[model samples]
Target chain A: MRFRFTGIFDLFNQKNEYYLINKKLDTIIQINESMYKVLSNAKQGTELNCNEINLNTMNILIYNRVLEAIN
Target chain B: MKRDLNKPIVIHWCMNNCNKQGQIPKGVIEGKIRQAEPIKIRFINPRSQEDWRIIESFANESSDIKEIQVEYDFLEYDIKHCIDIDIEKKLIYLVAFSGTSYLDHDARNRLCNMIKKQDNFKIIVYISHKNIAESVCFIQSVYNEVKQGEFIIKPEKNIKNELTDISVLHEAISQIAELYKLFPDIKLSVYDEEKIVRDIIRLPYYMYGNMYITGDGNISMYSFMPAYNYGLSDPQVTLEEAWRKLYHEHATCDLEKILEYPRYWFKYFNRKEIK
Candidate 1:
């Protein structure tokens, strides 16, 4: 279904690699360009269709608890 | 000409290998210099071995420099020699990191005794990312030591990275804000709305009547960002000439336009709820 990015995370690009830094957990996880684009465009509390992103990658992100489903 | 003591004079201590060293022109100190008002000088938290050696050497070169007060960093190096000489003078102990945790109870007691003896002294704790409860307890331990002195908690700046997360920065601001509630008397360097707006029209606080003396003896009107270079301090330039150049050049730039950038604007402006 639809999903949104977490508010506790900060997105940044360093050395051509994109990282999501979770301030609450003090953790950083690197993601690919496609994931970066999707996350960057997804506003907090807004829903994004699963078809908008690669289903396999989206599954991995949700599994890792980086992205949460809104509906 | 005698300088007025009432006016504020801010001095920035720089080491020889400072990043701005290359920017200073050579042989700028050959001319006669003007004398300014006599102000008390203090050195704060000099860390590097090279910096310490240069400071020691600089002090030895001039007896006047040796008399200047200092706030020694207990975490960096042994300040026994500095304490021995300036025992009677105003001393400051800057505790950063988990510096207090490293000291044994007896040593901590001795340190407090030394601080209590000084007529004018301060214990400034630089807040860091360490556990807040542990940090507060460390401060309280030293608090029990001194009878009368200023205890300040300052938020440390994140100077390394140009881009800092807004959330992280706000968290730091909130933490330091809470300290004011605990110790109402503590002073902070952050600007209020009045100060920020005042600076927007005029020069920022750091630029006002300030002089930076680098380790190589070069002088600049502004410490980190000098609009105009005043050359070396050895040959000596008049404080009037330096101020004139700094004020004149700084006035020409549109600070408002400069402040419009997200990073600069964010520093002075805070969002408040409309309700």
Candidate 2:
């Protein structure tokens, strides 16, 4: 199934570090450089195959409503 | 997003002589004057007839100006009778500032007296002093004299910090905590239910439908980001031309930009989870 990040998240770069802010929950979670790239893509509506991305990262994003099924 | 050109919620009109850079265009006023609906104007620290003349000129052009508020900076200028004239005319709602280093004893007394006299004004006391006793005393003195007026304590240390610095957020949270401990009655500006909901929805609260004119005649749509600077624009460029640059170059309130800006209260709220 194809998936994309929800609208509740936004990307920010503070002090050369990438952080994801949940606009709905007003929470911040720092993500690694690679994770940042993936999420940035997701934010731009890039679709991801469930098996392609890191499972743990996908699980966290899905669990937090950061990602939702495209279908 | 396209804003309703007809109605501008507020115009921050800085009437000071100092060349501090106003970001709102003269064209905004000129454009708004042609409309029937009067725009609200907040006069920032108006001190002279020159400022009043500007107000009169706008008033003469159109009846589009419905409300006027004065941000009275008591420290910089004396209590002028021109303000009294407007207040008497029911044309002014006052927002006065008083605090350490900003207001001397005599000035504080003058501010307090004005507050007591006016029924339509709020006094904001910015507390930046290290001594808690001194801070409390400053607040008490104002309250004691006025007897029935509200004063907001803005705990700012007068230090400029890069917006990206997390340490600054920590310092702000600590200061707020200190204030809460001493003055439990002190209210946070964020307690407004509407504003809370707006923040959650990522809607613009302060910057929504408002524009600014800085002291030096620079025009900006958002206070967080300045669109025009005299250094970048030509020295003889008109505010109309400057405003065009702002309109083309910047989004009024980009969500990514707003999220990136340092909202210390958000950090304070999600302190444990921010890392």
Candidate 3:
């Protein structure tokens, strides 16, 4: 339903440039050059799955733990 | 589809005044069939004490759920009912640290440190503060730093009395301590009343989490938090994708990394890292 592009914007650890394509809504929000790097560098790729902790924590789980690396 | 074009089966953490959140909080039952049918209702935040009761009354109002879930994470008041696990999607809506208090950064650091200790977990964290990690990520990806505060949360109505006493704080800290005891293998550290962060030390690697609680009611870390994490939807709630989504973006998202873009973390926060 939603599509996005992610990659490093620079070598130093500043700026971001990611493009989000919401196909369902026909909208593309280009992230700032600084932020794109922060999100992408946050973690590496993996598979996402659902396990039950409570009742409300089940919607979208990514398969990667890469969200951590980012500050 | 599931409903009219104008309506989607939205899972809302309805607050007391559209900011407090939650209307009910039982495992599952029955309740009023309104715009969102077959959807569970839980009280998230409240303008007054009465707001929570109204939501609790509806917890069993719906006969659809088998159990109720509640989480009071905020320091001020029981913020609201947390998100239930959406099993099919492998996603979870997590409670976020959103206020502009010093506690905001503290909670974020705690969450980041706590969750990162594990190898497998997922959380679609809800954000309350702009400087908080999740909100920061969302802002960097979608909005300008100047506009990040747009989504900041406040008491829908200024009623005050949201702060907690030391006794209540003790109860919360102990509950988490017990949770750590239950899940021995999961990553966590028990808090010692006398020891502060700098004075803290780890258990011997060999003796780490080797103990367990017997059938008796003996309180033990070995039998607590890890099990708590294991039993709760926590195992299923934390998403591997959610973590990677941020990391992958961070890897190549820097302006310099992406087409020679230039940006700084401090530039956005506009605060020096008091070294």
Top candidate (TM-score): 2
lDDT of 3 at A3: 18
Q: What is the TM-score of chain B alone in each candidate?
A: 0.56, 0.62, 0.27
lDDT-based ranking: 2, 1, 3
TM-score of chain B of 1: 0.56
DockQ of 1: 0.01
List lDDT for all candidates, in order.
Answer: 0.46, 0.50, 0.26
After the best TM-score superposition of candidate 1, give how far the Cα of residue B201 lies from its true spot, in angstroms. Answer: 5.1
lDDT of 1 at B244: 58
Q: What is candidate 3's CA lDDT for residue A53?
A: 18
- Model 3 lDDT tens row, B130-245: 22333334323222212111122221111111112345434444543443354443322222211211121121111111111112111112211111111212223221222233
Q: What is the DockQ of each candidate?
A: 0.01, 0.02, 0.02
Instruction: Score residue B84 of candidate 1 by CA lDDT.
Output: 42
On residues B1-275, what C-alpha lDDT tens digit does candidate 2 reach at each position? 12223223345666564444543444444343233232456667666665655554554443534555556665655545443444344444444443444566787677777677776556554443343345456655555556655554453422332322557545544654665565566433312222232354343112233455666555565333343453323435544444455655653344234454345333233234323
List model 1 lDDT by residue over B1-275, tens digit each: 11222221434444334455463332232121113431323454565554454445434443222134455555455566433464434333443344235676766766676567654455555454443345556655565445455555543332232213467556655655665566665432332222233343442212233455554544443332323445445345665565556555662353444355444433223222211
List candidate 3 stretches off by more than 4 Å: A1-71, B1-8, B11-13, B18-36, B65-73, B78-94, B103-275
lDDT, candidate 2, residue B246? 60
Superposition error at B206 for model 2 (Å): 9.6
lDDT of 1 by residue, A1-71 (tens): 66777564656554445556442222335556776777887744546767777777677567655678765
Off by over 4 Å in 1: A1-71, B1-8, B15-34, B45-69, B83-87, B90-107, B128-137, B144-148, B158-207, B216-229, B233-240, B251-258, B261-275
